[model samples]
Target: MFSGAQISLYPMTDDFVGVILGALGALDPYRDKLRIETDDISTLLVGPPEVLFPAMRDLFVAAAASGKHCVLSAAISRGCPGEPDDPICRSDAVGGPVGPLSLRKDAAIAAVREADVTGQPVAVQFSLYVMGTGDHMDEIYGCIDFLKQSGVFDRSKHFCSRLRGDAGAVFSTLNEAFCRFGPGAGHVTLDVTVSANSPTAI
Candidate 1:
């Protein structure tokens, strides 16, 4: 029942260093709850999905609040056979008896609807991978159906689906997709890229 994310932030501005450094403060509240390590490439956050997504949301929102175009790319995963399990990474969000796909979708949608609003608008595109399962495609398709019904759903892209809305809902939607689609205790990962205040957005 381990979970975590490797995330990187890219700010388009002359003061990228300043923006990045300042935005890091947003993770202060989550410091005690997560094992976070930053290196030259990305920051690795090891924690429950409940804390992981919000931590990422706050960090990205803080950076975007600078009024600069910002992109946050993340590789989120759970139940990886290669990674040793840590008690800090345990969470109720995932790992349990599997339920019907339709029921999971409904619950996921409800969770998104109840998500807190952050006011900062963002767009996200991501692909979900439900590994170590024979019915992986079925799970992915089920997740796609859930996304389309999600209020933030924008469109379906070539290799991924897009979501646009307030940061809260967008991240909540991502959390649900990561938690609900695949086998509760199986290996699942998300490849996500989020953007805010993009100058070239149309």
Candidate 2:
């Protein structure tokens, strides 16, 4: 599907050029996996969640590592609107691509398990929707349980059970949830919205 993120980075400092450059540079290594476009306002990254979320995690980590107050605003979406017949948006039942259903869930889980967010005040908020399933809420809760035990979740920040926490952990949790429920037997689609920022300068 057309999973991607439109991102804007703001650094709270006078000489912000280097911080911006460094943050962008962190994404350079993932160039092969993502389609990145930057302008005066924001950077658009189009790719699968497996690659996109981690890349975002690295980008935000790089920005936060600069020891400046940084805020990353992003809009994450999936599916190709107005192109319902497109293979990316259509399900396998209609002879569409099914790679997303079989995405490596273990890899995403491992990524989140390995991330360290100690002492980082990064905050992230995201909502995940698993569509076209009779047991959608069950699947959604299953994913939520996974995120809760991951240790990066800020339980107090939750509103309606949405997740918020360290950028890396949040991205990793998102990746896991997306892959696990994205293209499964009962799931035909998945939608996610995410916003991440560091409220306190490190």
* Clash tally, candidates in order: 0, 0
Q: How good is model 2 by TM-score?
A: 0.67
Model 1 CA lDDT for position 121: 98
Compared with the true structure, what per-residue lDDT tens digits does model 2 show for residues 46-164?
77666677787788778888887777777665653532222323322222333432233344466678865634445555556756547667655666666666666656334333556
Candidate 1 lDDT score at position 30: 97
Q: Give the poorly placed runs of model 2, Cα more than 4 Å off.
A: 81-111, 114-121, 131-136, 156-168, 182-202
Tens-digit per-residue lDDT, 1-202, candidate 1? 8899999999999999999999999999999999999899999999999999999999999999999999999999999999998999878889998999999999999999999999999999999998887899999999999999999999999989999999999999999999999999999999999999987885
Candidate 1: how large is its RMSD? 0.6
| TM-score for each candidate, following the candidate numbering | 0.99, 0.67
Looking at model 2, how many pairs of residues clash? 0
Global local distance difference test of model 1 = 0.95
Candidate 1, run of 10 with poorest lDDT: 193-202
TM-score top scorer:
1
